[model samples]
Target chain A: MKANKVLINTLAIAITFMTLVPFVWMVSASFMHQGEANQFPPRLFPETFSLEHYLRLFISMNIVRYFLNSVLLSASITGLSLLVNSMAGFAFAKFHFPGKESLFKLLLAAMIIPAQVTMLPLFLMMNQLGLINSYFGVIIPGMASIFGIFLIRQYISSLPDSLIEAARLDGATDFQIYWRIVLPLAKPILVTLGLFTFMGTWNDFMWPLIIMTRESMYTLPVAMANLSGEHSQDTELMMAGAVITVLPVIIVFLALQRFYIEGIMLGSVKE
Target chain B: MKGKRLFKVWMSPALFLAPALLLIAVFFFIPVVVSFLMSFTDFDIYSLADSSNARFVGLENYKNLLSDPLFWKAMHNTLYFVFIGVPLSLFVSLGTALLLNSKLIRFMSLFRLAYFLPVVTTLVAVAVVWRYIYHPSFGLVNYLLSLIGVSGVDWLGNPNWAMPALILMAVWKNFGYNMIIFIAGLQNIPPELYESAQIDGAGRWQELLHITIPMLMPTTIFVSIITIIGYFQLFAEPYVMTQGGPMNATLSIVLLMYQEGFRWWRMGYSAALAFVLFLILFAATLIQLHLQKRFSTV
Candidate 1:
């Protein structure tokens, strides 16, 4: 029995190392000088740590522009999506309307249809609208989503309706009730959904790859992909790029892990 | 005053819902129909310039895709991924969840963070990092293997090892997600069931087999379905790491569609590929649901 306990603990330690080694190596390798990572024995740590590649990334690569673009896009998509999806989610939760059930059912059914099916024609439509190679091409499609509405609606429905009713009896406009009461009360779910949207938009690769054709407009992920193609030989340089692209989302995730993990449970249970 | 209130009540939902509804209609629903229509026509670069140039070649793209060797290889590779990757991921996820759930382990949060850190990071960035990790001679994986007397294997360079390399990386990236779900499911299982099993003198292994596995069925089904659907669309990893291979070993269905539509401008074929992906997922979900209904006495 004692041996079994030791065995289990050792297993945990081993798997944890296996899980974390790549990230540790990436960070370590990013600090290594050029040609240093190709050591025969495979150095796990940089012997002489340097910031030269990071300097090159900033001065020569203009990665700051891509970084700003990613931040700008993620924040906008989160804010807009929160507003649009919440309004719709609020209506479904508190208000009655004709065709509401069928409409929601239709929306739910549409979830099963993969977004890839829509991309080809969606690209054509973007071209027709002259939104191609523009941030709006990415933003407009993401401004509202079915899953976002469904998530917000589920949470909002669980809140007591008496609050909205009292606000209404006191002559509060529906918008006022939504903006004032529902918004504050629904803050947790909003944070959860907002984190989801922010992280999703930050890490998204394919749509940005399609829409943002201009080098100046590329998100961090798209820019990194482009770099990997051209600078495939520069291990240290590419590792620095990966660290830059990955570090922000990691910080966000760790900072807001409670809300993020809450979102995960809600996703599983709510669905 | 009452009339005004009634008017506001009636018009409010319309105002609240219209913008989102309109956007979804234009961007999502209409585009789905447009793609379906385009799949019937021979839409290429020519038609992309002028609508009149597209020939309504009914079912031709689907017929051609059905017989195309590359499409079949992609289909086979995708199925191979789904079949092997889904269960392997679940196994790892459940293993980690069980380990983390054990009372013997401390620092559960730290362990969880380590496991899940890969999941939230950008896939392209990690794929790039993993590309170097799978390097022929200087890689950590090869070096570690050498210690155990297994000589270096060309991971990304060999067709046989390429898909498995991508799968291992994918599994590493993904298992933490399902692990979280499984942990939740494990916690929700009634402690009374375990207590009763122990009172009946059941050993740990027997209790786990009879009680834990049986109780976790619904969660297992949910995780597997989502995992299958998500794994079916494998693009970014192979794109960043192998570029669909040392010889097309890692080319997936969506990757093929991306190449056909984006690279070659063959919109009709790509649209058809999209529909086919949708059909496959629908069939997969239905099969899972049917199996659930058949076996689930609860």
Candidate 2:
């Protein structure tokens, strides 16, 4: 039994290391100076690490612009999506509309209709609105997702109605009740949903790749794909770009992982 | 009294739902309808320059799609991806979940975090990293293969290996998510069942086969459905890694749509492609649900 336990522990360690090697290699390769990572035998560590690639990215590649665009776009989308989705989610959960159940059911069923189905018409719509090649193009369609609303509604529905009733008796307005009573009560789900929106907007590639035609408006992943096209042979530099694109998400997930993981579990359990 | 209360409820729900519903209708629903309409007409580069140039092509684009060998290639590639990728990911997720859920496992949190880190990372960046890892001459993958006397195969450049490579990366990136779900499913299984099996002189393998597998079926089915749906929509990886290239071996349905719609501005044809994909996904989802119902009834 003791031998079996040791073997199992060893296997777990091996698997963990295997899982981490790709990310570790990405980080390590990013630190290597140009030409350092391309050596035979695949150097696990750079002989003399330098920040030159990162410097080059910000100075030569105008990556700072792309980085800022990503940050600003992700922030705006997250904030606006949270506000819109939470209101909708709260209504679905707590309010008793004539078609509340049916509407909610429709949204749930519509979830399976992949977002790709809308891309063509959405692009035309954006073009018509003059939002194409603008940040608003990427931000508009994503401002309120059915999934976000569903997630929030599922969490908020469990909140006690007594709280809202007491607030109403105090002559608090519906908006006030939502702001003071419901929003605060649903903080955990809000954070989780917010993280989902932020990460999703940040990581999104294809939509931005389509809509954001101008180089200046490009988000990180879109910019990175463009950069890769131009600099595919620049392995070390490409690694630096990948690191920049992936690092913020990795950091955010590490920081708020409890909520993120909980969100996934929540989604799964409800199904 | 009931009328007044009903009115109040209606007003509140309307107020709450207005923003999200409006966004969905304007952005999602309207576009989907317009795209469907556009697919019936010949909306292409000529139409872009002058809307008057567009004409009703009827089934011309759909007919072209059927004859277009590229479209068939994409269909085959996407089907291959879904058929192979889904089960492989499910198996890996289940295996990892069982391992992590084992009582003897130590440092479970650390292991869980390690496995899950890939899922949350940006796909474009991960694709970029994997692109490097697949480099024929000097990549880590090739280097590792060399140690075992295996010649370095051009992973992305080769038509035969490109889809499989993408599938491998996808599975690596996604399995952790379902693994987390599977872990939850595993934990919910009653320990008494395992104990009773053990009391019957069953070994660990028998207990797992008899108890754990049966109990986890519902979770597995749900996971498989979602995974299949997600895999069918493959785009960014091929767009970034292969550009659906080396003979169009990696062109997925969404990638095909993107090319026709955005790259070539064949909006009408692209919309039809999108609808076809939707039909396929809807059919698959219904089939899974029906199977689940049948199994539960039995």
Candidate 3:
């Protein structure tokens, strides 16, 4: 049993190291001078440190513009979707109307329809509206997501009805009750859902890749893909690009991982 | 006063729901319907240039898709990924979860965070890093192999190895996600079941086989379905790392759809491919549910 415990501990540490190796290598290679990353026997660490690639990315490549674009896009989507979906989620949780149950069920059923099905027509629709190659094309479709609505609705429903009733007795209007009582009390799910939306939009590749056709409008992931295409041989430069692209989301996730992980659990558990 | 108050109550929910519901309707619902329609029509660049140029080509796209060798290749490649990758990924996730649940493991949360770090990183970055890591001549993988007196395999350049290379990276990127879910599942298992098994002289493996595995079946099913759906849509890794190359060994359905629609402007055919993928996912989900109902230990 002692030997078995030792073996388990060893395997656990080994797997953890192995899991982190790719990320470790990514950060390490980003600081290597050009061609050092590809050396035979693969120098695990740079013999001499360099920042040539990061300088190239920020100075000449002008990656800051793409970085800001990603940040602004993700932030806008997260903020807008939260407001819109939360209103709907609040109503679904507390209000009643004809066909309310049916409508909610329909929305739930629609979740299975993959977003790819809507991409073609949505692109064409955006083109007709002259929204293509701009943030509008991305943000308009992102203003509401069914999963966001469902998650918020699930959390809000679990809140006691007495709070809303008390708010109503205090002559709080419907909007005021939601804006004041519901939103604050539901802050945990809001953060969880917010992190979900933010990380999703930040890491999103496909929609932005399709809509943001111009180089100036490219998000970091789209820009990263273009860079990798144009500079496949420049391994060090690409690693630097990869590092900066991944860093912001990684930082956000690490800072709020409790909310993030709980959000996943909430999503997986059936309502 | 009663009527006025009733009207206000009626309007409240509608007002709350309108913006979100309208956006879903216009952007999501309408597009889904239009895409289904567009699949039957030959919607191409000329049609985009002038709507009058488009013509309905019912079943032609689907017909051609059935006969298309590349589509079959894409299908074959995707199934290879789903069939082989899903089980392997689940195994890794479950194994790590079990290890983490062990009392012997210290700093379990730190290890969990390390494992999950890849899941939250952008796939584009991960794929690009992996592209270099799979380099035949000077990659870390080959370098490590050389230490074992093994020859370096051309991971991404060789047709036979490219898909496997991709699968390994994908499993690495995704396993942590399901591992967390599995860990959650394991915590939900009643300890008494294990204790009872121990009292019955059941060993560790026997306890796991009898109690833990059966207890975690629901979570396993849910994780499998979610993983299958996500894995079926494999695109970014191949797009960055392989470009679906080395004889198109890693061409996925979505990658093919993107290439056909956006790159080639074959929107109608692309929509058809997308629909076929949806049908497959729907069937896969239903089949899993059916199997769970039949065999559910819970």
2 or 3: which has the higher DockQ? 3
Q: Which sections of candidate 2 miss by over 4 Å? A: B1-7
lDDT of 2 by residue, B48-164 (tens): 767678788888878988998988999999999999999999999999999999889898999999999999999999999999899988788999999999999999999999999
Q: B170-285 in candidate 3: lDDT tens per residue?
A: 99999999999999999999888888888899988898888888888888888999999998999998898889988999999999999999999999999999999999999988
What's the lDDT for all of these models? Answer: 0.92, 0.90, 0.92
Candidate 3 residue pairs that clash: none
lDDT of 3 at B181: 94
What are the DockQ scores of the candidates, in order? 0.78, 0.83, 0.84
Which 10 residues in a row give candidate 2 chain B its minimum summed lDDT? Answer: B45-54
- Of candidate 2 chain A, the 10-residue stretch with the lowest lDDT total is A262-271
Expressed as tens digits, the lDDT of each residue in A19-82 for candidate 3 is: 8898888888888988988789787777789999999988998699999999999999999999
Quality of candidate 1's docking, in CAPRI categories?
medium
Ranking by DockQ: 3, 2, 1
